[model samples]
Target: MTALPLTALPTARPDGCPFDPPRELAALRAGHPVSRMTYPDGHEGWLVTGYGPVRAVLADPRFSSRYELMHFPIPGGPEGTLPPAPVGDMTGIDAPEHTRYRRLLAGRFTARRMRLLTERVEEITAEHLEAMAHGGTETDLVTAFAQPVPALVICELLGVPFADRETFQRHVHTLMSLDVSPEDRVAAVTGMHRYMLDLVCTKRAAPTDDLLGDLTASDLTDEELAGLGGFLLGAGLDTTANMLAHGTFALLTHPEQLAALRADPDLAESAAEELMRYLSVAHTMVRVALEDVELDGRTIKAGETVTLSVEAANRDPERFADPDTLDIRRKATGQLGFGHGIHQCLGAQLARVEMCVALPALVRRFPALRLAVPAAEVPLRTGMNVYGVHRLPVALA
Candidate 1:
């Protein structure tokens, strides 16, 4: 009922904030629906915190996801210098263009296509758990389990060389880690673009039947190719890695959930959903308004940024009863973990399938997977856009 400045919203969480972001949204739904706030880039935008309002913002045609593609208004800065465009094909395009490229991406991530990758995912999970087993008792699960498996799987899918994983992973670490400085962010983005461009050239020369090669066959120009490859690298590498790491951490800490998942492998499917809801890794969804829009009686101006707290939406009390409690058997049909609308995650199916396969396999293979150190003592990576456990020290009992 009362209007609040977005600056009045809480930002500092030294103990580490999970990606479950809608704390402000919950406050908004309870009190303030449309709140004004400054974005990380210092631009003023409206933060939509309620479920209906957020969903309307996502589905409405007046909102544009292509703010990254064009010189759009930033709230505070002098006409924002369009940061160098993302060197990959993804959320930066509008309907016809986005739809065109999405068709190409849809082919590789279909349920049928994902089924083919299942065995490989299981093998990779088993291999990582085995390697962790061989290493002396305590191993950082982020390094030992979470990071490598998805990196290997995604690399295999895109035909990126395994030897190049460390190289690309460094660029990825710099890009996703909260620790990187502003200057370092640009450098990492540029470096990642360069890595992807070189990989594209190699794929051009000796075409393999991987996702990269498939994209080259499309009508995309060289610039678009870079965008496509860069998008995949950024989206594929970190998101899956976060899911794997954070999901594992969530399960390992919840003994009853872990035991239930171990007892019935079918629980893996539901567990994956619960974990995605629990972690809500992608954090927030940013959209620019193409026209002035009225949301919950508050008008958002054209060309202004509107961020939907997908993390909060997923945990909305209206949507999920007892939203904070992780329930493996919980029906998770409408959760916004991968978002909703036409721009929903293209790789959601693959990511979910990977989790269903990877999580159960890791626990079944090790049977005694428990944290090697106290949960409180574990070091979490700070300042990251993508939330994940940095180090999950676990022992094979």
Candidate 2:
């Protein structure tokens, strides 16, 4: 295959951070709404940043998510712009297949169902706070608070033995880290696959009333079950962990907002929405044009990759007035934090419930909390899948 020309694609940023593509995306939106570009992995694809185009690509079933598994059709990646092999296979399938697999687990992730886990989420958050205090007020929240909350929550939800959490959590971090090699990532994925396989078999032998057990009883093949279980484990762990860490950092840094949230616990939902908007954690949503489609006056040929900049769309000036400033009271009418259309995050309700419970509990538990390291001194995991602080060192009040 001939190398795609860089004539139209913008220059690659030095770091090539996926999480913080907001800036470069801004430039793309302003200069070329539907620009041709090469992805970090060196695959050639169309970068669609405008509000209308991004929404169109995401909502249309004509744009498939299946192409994400194979080598991306771009230039500059390890395999000359090919899509890297995925750890699991669910992310790359289409339609009724995607629909059926997603449905098998939908009942477990509903907002009402997730609500049942609130007390437990708050209990875990409080226990972590007490542990942080005993360990000394000055502690790394990422390790002490942020990471464990979601890790424990997801573990309990999946009915995975708490003893296995250390192993699973470690793999989740390595698998999601952009700095890690693709081979290491594939290893992590395989490890998780083995874990899920063992879990399913164990559940079959001694079924429990948990999500995984229910999945075992479903009319799904082992491959389908593995795809669904692997998908849930990864989806539940990485994104929520980032949210806890990033949301905490965002709140702590913005003292007024933090105070507001602390003062009124009800603000947690709105605060979470605002934080999701501001942080815009997941960098972009990948899609393949199922067929030739016209979007915002640009013709996207069938089979081309269309990368929707979710972070960019969330902050689009045309969509949100004064989008840069974070405002909790503001209504998050159409923010795609959980995405949109058929493939929107199934665990979104659970994630929000966890956040709503955890945030208020953290502040109420430690009213005098303040950062041990200065805000600027805190190292951010920049340009990655889930942007967050590496460590949130804090002294409990």
Candidate 3:
């Protein structure tokens, strides 16, 4: 088969449309779900935009998630590129090595275990909502509520001191940001590793009742433990925080949907799923083919990168009816928001718990919640890997 024209990824969303995937991505998926695209660095690769193909590729063992194997799909030079994930960062490692860490940690994040954290999540949500109620009539939800709720939850689960949140959060911000210098990114990563190393050592001496402490029973070394701790901390913090902030923005802007959720608190679970599907923040992921493999009739050669547009896939019309619409009542099962397959998000349930507890609690607490600024003026985190707002100023009228 002749290859599709090699074009750059269509990453630009329509002006003023925050909840939708990039317009070009949707168009591309509709026509050529798998098409050749040139990365910013000028490497030609495949872009999978369809729901089935994206999910299939994510599940396929032939596709490699190793960081060193992928080419950056987004534009920018050396600064935009990230080196391979460090030792114990499970996201970058393939099976066996990846399976080892995953096995030790997966037991800790089981549905039953996560459900056990519901009461604690409720407490955290209530505390933040209460603080917001009295702190001011108007404030940035991202800072005061969205960011901190999950931040605190992760602290409790990881046994990290909540007081030192600013230290880790700032470092995480550096690590996730596209604007920072390599030096600063390295510094943030190094700083986090050092902090986690000290904590891991402490945990080794006297285990606490937390995820890291639980892992001490495993044969992981101090360096590996430190890396995993930092990795887990960074993973837990930013993604869900953005989801809350972005989900709130999505709900408030769509009044009927917001009203549906507010009128029925029981809608929280589906509402969180709908929000995740609607705002696919961790929009794009890459997987390089390990060898020649047939996918949807096309052969993806080994070492050629395939950018999986899960954001576009989530909105695929075939899989989702009126996929662009935000309907909280819709049963959003199989949404690729947390992704699919072996490398699916480790903390997906915890994130779901955070979103389900925090987003609805936020709305219920401030029945009169609204955007303090015009929706247009609210800043978007377009530059970062995580899609969300920088500040979601809201009036708890």
Which segments of candidate 1 are over 4 A away from where they belong? 13-25, 39-43, 68-84
What is the number of residue pairs that collide in model 2?
A: 18
**What count of clashes does model 1 give?**
10
Kindly provide the TM-score of model 1 when superposed on the true structure, using C-alpha atoms.
0.90
Best by lDDT: 3
Each candidate: what lDDT? 0.74, 0.72, 0.88
**lDDT for predicted candidate 3 compared with the true structure:** 0.88
Superposition-based RMSD of candidate 2 using all C-alpha atoms, in angstroms: 3.8
Model 3 ranges off by over 4 Å: 1-3, 77-82
- Per-residue lDDT of 1-397 in model 1, one digit per residue for the tens? 5557665234343443443453555777557656776654556777766767778877787888784523322232224524544645467667887888878788788989988998998888888877877887777778887878888888888887878878778887886765556688678777877777788787788788888887788777766786677677667778888788778777788889889999999998888888888677776667888888888888888877876766677777877888878888998877777877888888888888788988888888778888887777766554566777677788877
- TM-score of every candidate relative to the true structure: 0.90, 0.90, 0.97
Off by over 4 Å in 2: 1-22, 40-43, 68-77, 80-89
For 1-397, candidate 3 gives per-residue lDDT tens digits of 4556655666677888987888888777878888888777767779999999999999999999998888888765352334888878888889999999998899889888999999999998898888888887999999998889888999999999999999999999988886677788789988999999999999999999988998898899999999999999999999999999999999889999989888898999999898889899999888999999998888888888899988999999999999999999999999998988999999999998888888778888899999999999999998788889999999998
lDDT, candidate 2, 1-397, per-residue tens: 2222333333233352322444666877866767776655555668777776787777898888774433332233234323533433556667777777777777778878889898898789888888877887588878887777877887788777767877777777776675677688778878877887777788888988777777778887665565566767777877887888778777777788889988888788888887777777875677877788987767778767777777777878888888777777777777887888887888888889878888788888888888887776777776355667677788886
Candidate 1's displacement at residue 264, Å, is: 0.9
For model 3, what is the error of residue 289's alpha carbon versus the real structure, in angstroms, after optimal superposition? Answer: 0.5
